[model samples]
Target: MTELARLKFYATQAHPCSYLPTEQATTLFLDPSQPMDAQVYAELSEVGFRRSGDHLYRPHCQKCSACVPARLPVADFKPNRQQRRILSRNADLQVRAVRPAFSEEYYDLYARYIEQRHADGDMYPPNREQFSTFLVRDLPFSRFYEFRLGGRLLAVAVTDVLPNGLSAVYTFYDPDEEHRSLGRFAILWQIAETARLGLHAVYLGYWIKNCRKMNYKTQYRPIELFVNQHWAILT
Candidate 1:
């Protein structure tokens, strides 16, 4: 076993669950002092760990197992009619993958996204500090995929490239572009990019069964869920 295999983890005290408000949630986090990299991250991801900012963690709730780690096996994925339409709808948008950095244009869109779409959520009342801490981190594998139309920035998909595949960290878009379904489009774009790069899968964080916000994840057919210490297809 490697050093990562012997890594220590600490669990958080029970707190209000973000997905299910009625329940409490505890998170098991990798030791922050441990040096982490793409290789170690990929190893942890295979066992259902996820990254939030610079922290690698997974839900460790005692009473609920609603947050299931999910990933798309790129080779076996087939987009449905609606997903295909989303791709066609946003076909004109140009995508560019750049290093993760603080950008005025990106931050403006992020603020608007949080204000308009997630006003009631924890990220509401967004500010520069919160924005930077959440998305802009110093990680070698991190990338900010900018979606532009006629040179105007419209959306950004914050992704991390792991050894095995890409991890979809977070996505934000112009509030006015709701009709375009840019959020869904971002995931579809990642799937295509992952396939083009010969990756095995696209890790799409946790999928909570009872969370309406997470229901969208299920639309992507043939998603594998990490259950009982194994990756199993959710039927």
Candidate 2:
């Protein structure tokens, strides 16, 4: 069989849904023993899988189809009034894509972000190992985008470079910079960068309409959601 043909998937047992606490969730993931192939990874991405550390996974809940994979077609994206304002608001912040590495500075920013914004979530009380493993993996396609103002760190957007598009793995910013809306700014920047690089889409991972934290993804207009085995326009 071909390399792609050799792929296999396993589903985890039911557990509390991370997005909606009222539901149970399961996840489908690739075999950890299989070596990661970029082409294979890209293909899987088209169907909704995402990378977490060294593994690729997606929500596999049987009873709930609320979780829907979403991506933005960069060329067709038109920043809404609010999004354009978010971009213009943070115009002073310098942005750059650098090699992914673990630094106390990044970790400190991440720790503070989690403690303030996600203290009630699973990533509450962030530590070095969790930070390193989640975002600092040595994958060839991984990149860390640092947003700074006058050389002071404000946010870090962890992204994955894919064959056809960019995947927004995660983003964390200074809670103190709440007016900057750094998290939303990071995604807007990525969409613009993806188009500048001649890419097609920016994968924003999954969105569940009922989940307040995830529903914001719809603000990016002209979104295409992978549903019923095909990408359907959700605009």
Candidate 3:
């Protein structure tokens, strides 16, 4: 953790917590001017920091520690019945890992998804600029993986190819195809892909036990949580 300790961090003023509205949250981010590369990013990731746009950050709230960093240990993960069924359901999706750049097709699906499913959230009424700033970064590790059906895009998993594992930054899909559970399938696929790449784990951002939207990350068995300055099994 010396690597993280030596880096400069700037804390954001306390703001309303995005996941838990009942609380206020602050974020600790790496110095914007810091020279960031894959190795540096991986070191920070190992210590629970995550990337958002050009910034690498983590929850820095004094009173609220609900946003615990979570990761799925690749070697220990095994899909359950429902996850297997989801895999079977999305067997036809042509998932392709392409460079991280904006695509009108991907944006259309993203706009529709936020409009319908996240209308009450901050990212509601999504626009091109928001999508570009949030996902399309000029980073060496950034990758945009698309899940398509018969050449029509259905979902996108914005990931980073970290040294130790893949970081699942964000995922948006066609809200119309809720039955397909593309979101769940995408995580499962990342786990398999992590194994294929001989990585250690999948860095799932944060998990809050009381937050339904965030807590679902625990569904991946043998997941590890960074708490009290250490990574430990949470299951």
* Candidate 2 whole-model C-alpha lDDT, 0 to 1: 0.91
The all-Cα superposition gives candidate 2 an RMSD in Å to the true structure of 1.4
Candidate 3 residue lDDT tens string, 1-235: 2465687889999999999989999999999999767888888887789999999999999998888899998998889999999999999889899888888988899999899989989998799999999998878889999999998899999999988999999999999999999889999999999999999999999999898888679888999999888899985
* Global local distance difference test of model 3: 0.91
Which residue runs does candidate 2 get wrong by more than 4 Å?
Answer: 1-3
Question: What are the candidates' C-alpha RMSDs?
Answer: 1.1, 1.4, 1.3
In model 1, residue pairs whose N, Cα or C atoms come closer than 3 Å (at least 3 residues apart or on different chains), thus clashing, are: none
lDDT per residue, candidate 1, 1-235, as tens digits? Answer: 2566589999999999877889999999999988767888899998889988889999999999999999999999888999989999999999999999998998999999999999989888999999999899979999999999989999999999987999999999999998899999999999999999999999999998889999998899789999999999889
Better of 1 and 3 by lDDT: 1
Better of 1 and 2 by lDDT: 1
lDDT of 2 by residue, 1-235 (tens): 1365668999999999888888999999999987776777788888899999999999998899998999999998899899989999999999988989999999999999999999989988899999998889888898999999988999999999888799999999999999988989999999999999998899999988888899778988899999999999995
* Model 2 TM-score, 2 decimals: 0.96
Clash numbers, per candidate:
0, 0, 0
- The TM-scores of all predictions, comma-separated, are 0.97, 0.96, 0.97
Model 3 TM-score is: 0.97
Quick one: best TM-score, which candidate?
A: 1
